[model samples]
Target: MNNLLQINSTDVTVFVFAGIIVLALLFGFIMYFLFSYRHKQKDFQLLHDQKQQIDVQKIELEKTLRELKSTQAQLIQQEKMANLGELTAGVAHEIQNPLNFVNNFSEVSNELIEELKTERQKTESERSAGTENDIINDIEQNLQKINYHGKRAESIVKGMLQHSRANAGVKEPTDINKLADEYLRLSFHGLRAKDKSFNADFKTDFDESIGKINVIPQDIGRVLLNLFNNAFYTVNEKRKSASDSYLPTVLVQTKKLNSAIEIIVRDNGDGIPKKIIEKIFQPFFTTKPTGQGTGLGLSLSYDIIKAHSGEIKVESKEGEGTTFIIQLPIL
Candidate 1:
């Protein structure tokens, strides 16, 4: 009976120890789960914060883009206004010559009319022999001068109209020779108007076989004018340091090939240095002094030619001269 009692007590002690061990294990598992859940929550918060930051950056980038676009628009508008102002000044300067001729001729014609009227009022006996014929000849000369001035004014107005019209990249059949020749003379006259003593030997070799090629007339005209203007400006600059015997000359030539048309504007003046020949077409790169060059002229010309599927190149020697060659496909 004592043995049986001892066994029962031992079994009860074992049961109590086993229950304590199970409780300890359960507590450890609950603590581990709690810590793991907290860690996951912290990670979630960090991820949410990063996403917010990215969203804010995206909004800021969009705002920056909007601002950039607005600024670009403003810059383009300013450029247009500047171009308009330049065109206005050029037209006004060019028209002065014809207007002066008209004014002077009008005054002379009026005087001649008065003189003829006076001679007519006088009796035939009082008037000297051939006086009437002399008065008639003078009046005819004045009328011719007035007519010539009127035609010149008309031509200037027509040219200005064509230049002002915004016919962007519209190609049409154009007489390349005529276009080249016209701009050559126009540029020379423009320089002469700016400086009374400016004179250059202008020459043209137009290929009759070139016929007509499809092109943007106004754009090409502007290109020619820019090139001719540059050529004239170069020669004139050279003339300043050159002797009186130095005759500034500009030559324009056109050639028709089986597949392409080539136009060349060459000058005998101070040439472009080799280093700068590459940068002449870059925007805002100019060899001229401030207020003398915008530097955008050649850049714009390059862009225009590129748009037309053509190529423009320059050849120069340091002390000789520069030649600009333009080649356009026959398509």
Candidate 2:
């Protein structure tokens, strides 16, 4: 009985040891699986983070590309303007010589016509009185028309020369009144030349006390011309849809201050909308049709005013009128 008990005890011990080995193997397998799963999860998270960073970088690149394109376009526009300025100066100079000749000869021809008329009148006879008088009158009328148009052409050429001059970059003592009046008439006549029936009630009130001011006349002239042109164009557009009783009027006035000069250009025309008023001075912003305007007028004028240590502002009411106020230092 003792031998049997010892043998049974030994068998039980062996069974317990085998069971322990099985459990150890099972636990090892579970740990290996958990570690492998964790490694895969970490890799997937890292990939996700890298993708997000790439997306952000792509967005930034796109923004940078857009800004670069805008800058490039502005540079191109500036280059084009410079080239156009050179071309305009060349054309104006070429036209100026012939224009002077035309004006000079026209004046001389007018004097000769008057002298011929006088001689014909003194030698008048009943034999050919009616025919001779009619010929002389026709000649005189033709010469008068020629002289008038020649003067107009000369004025236009002079304006072109002034506009193309490089003197706009320099400041000199200038007659403000004379400059304003000269440009006002030039702008009006330029419009008239384009549209024969275009007319406006123009008024001016210049302060004589303003006297001479040190300024870049060419630049200021350009600014004034731009303002006048806009005023005329606005009123002309309004006239198209307005009643016959509606008379378009543009008024220009100047005032002398202690240390500054003020110019006000007002027009009875369709005024600017509030939403777009702020954008008027921005480069390439314009209300005019695509081909009718380059949109640089106000922008250039604004820069010019700044360069002169001056200020420009606008006041407008829809359907009533618009006014542009420019203030320049007396210096």
Candidate 3:
């Protein structure tokens, strides 16, 4: 009986240990599954957040693309307007000649008519009275007025025809100084047409030794015109509120440096800001308010000079003035 009891007791202890181990293993498995599920949930949340971020970025990119397209369309429209302005200016220049002829001829014709009427009245009176002196004096006076007016009308027509033709096809070795002078006059005339009291003090310093340059006369003339226009615009703005003693001025000068010729256009108007100085040569960069500037004049001028193997540079100080220096190869 004792031996049987001892064996039963040992068996019960082994059974108890086995139950404890099985319960511990079950708890461990449950804990592992809970941790694994939590880890999966965290990973899923991270992926969901990543997708949301990607969606937001896509939306921003689409918005940016739309903005770019809109800006490009506006630039295209501005370019078209600029081209139209150039065409209009050219046409206006052509029409001025004929208009000038019409004006001059009309004045002369009116004066001649008046003189003829006076002579007819005098002749009628003299013939009725049989007075020889009155007839002779009337004939002399009428002839003088007719001759004067006829010559005046002819002169006007000739001038008008001459102005109508292109005056700059001939590319001869022209003195740079003289070409500059002519452009200066034309530029001033253009400004005066727009504003009668817009005169600014103009000065020039030409290097006599620079001599002639090989360039298309019209092209150079146009370049000078652009420069003069900018200068006048700047000076005019400053002189709007300036005292008579503070009259604005522009200085144009030329110098020969080694194998290159340098021309400078300087103005005492409000200078360009530093942040934009580098961007001034870029197409469509303008300091002037909208509708006041086309912004292509300088860019086109820059391209023309570059095609001639030249360079343009600027030096400016805010509130003082700005200077544009153009350097061209002497050869």
Candidate 4:
């Protein structure tokens, strides 16, 4: 009986210990599952926040691109307006010359007509035949004057019309020297008309041997006008500070090289500074203060000559003067 009771007790203790260990293991598994679920939820929240940040960044970038494109369009429109303004201003200046001639001539003709009528009445009433002859002479002289002024006006109008015409394709066998001379005179005259005292002594030494070349006359004329205007401005600026004894001079010379024609424009004004020489040809670069210059003149002139398979160069020294040398191929 005693042996049976001890064996039953040992079996009971072993089963009880086994049951307690299984319960502990079950509890540990439940706690582990809860902790893992919490960690996964936190990870999902972080990923959602990151995605929102990325979306926000994309929206900002898209806005910036739209703004940039809008700004670019505005700038292009502004440039077009500026160009139109320049063209209108130049056209107005061109029309003023003939209008002035017309006004002056019309006034003179009206005065002459009234004077002739008065003289004829006097001749008829007093039987003064000599007065009638004088009246005829006066009418003839006035008529000639009118014709002269009319022709002058016509020539100016024609020149302007020719200049304003749409450029035909480049023509060959063009006399470059003559074209240069024409532009030189026109530029000088235009400047003189604007300011009567702006006249300076101009000397030309065109190479008679510079044979005809392929060029567009109107385009080249615009280039020459730009260059000549610069030269004129330089001389005029210098003359302002010059003593009464100083005489302003501008020299324009041309020569024919082996395969090209070179033209030189020299002025006795203050030369370009060393520091800014390299930038002079750059677009929108100018030494003139403020409104005195548009700064596009040289840049445009440079481009035009380069398009014609030519080169332009400048040389200068401080306190001395500046010279621009342009070379074009003789085709």
State each model's C-alpha RMSD to the native.
7.8, 12.5, 13.5, 11.1
Candidate 2 ranges with C-alpha deviation above 4 Å: 1-159, 166-168
Estimate the TM-score of every prediction: 0.64, 0.58, 0.52, 0.56
Candidate 1's error at 180, in angstroms? Answer: 1.3
Candidate 1 CA-lDDT value: 0.81
| Top lDDT model | 1
Clashes within 3 Å, all models in order: 0, 0, 0, 0
Model 3 scores worst on lDDT over the 10 consecutive residues at 159-168
Off by over 4 Å in 4: 1-159, 165-169
lDDT of 4 by residue, 121-205 (tens): 6745665768657766766776676677667556555645545554333656777777777667666766776676785778899
Per-residue lDDT for 236 in model 4?
85
Can you rank all candidates by TM-score, best first?
A: 1, 2, 4, 3
Which stretch of 10 consecutive residues in model 1 shows the poorest summed lDDT?
A: 75-84
| Candidate 1 C-alpha lDDT tens digits along 21-97 | 98989998999999998999899989999999999999999999999879754543443344444445455665777
C-alpha positional error of residue 170 in candidate 4 after TM-score superposition, expressed in Å: 2.0
Clashing pairs in 4: none
lDDT of 3 by residue, 50-128 (tens): 9899999999999999997787556534543443343343334434554555556556556656655665678554544
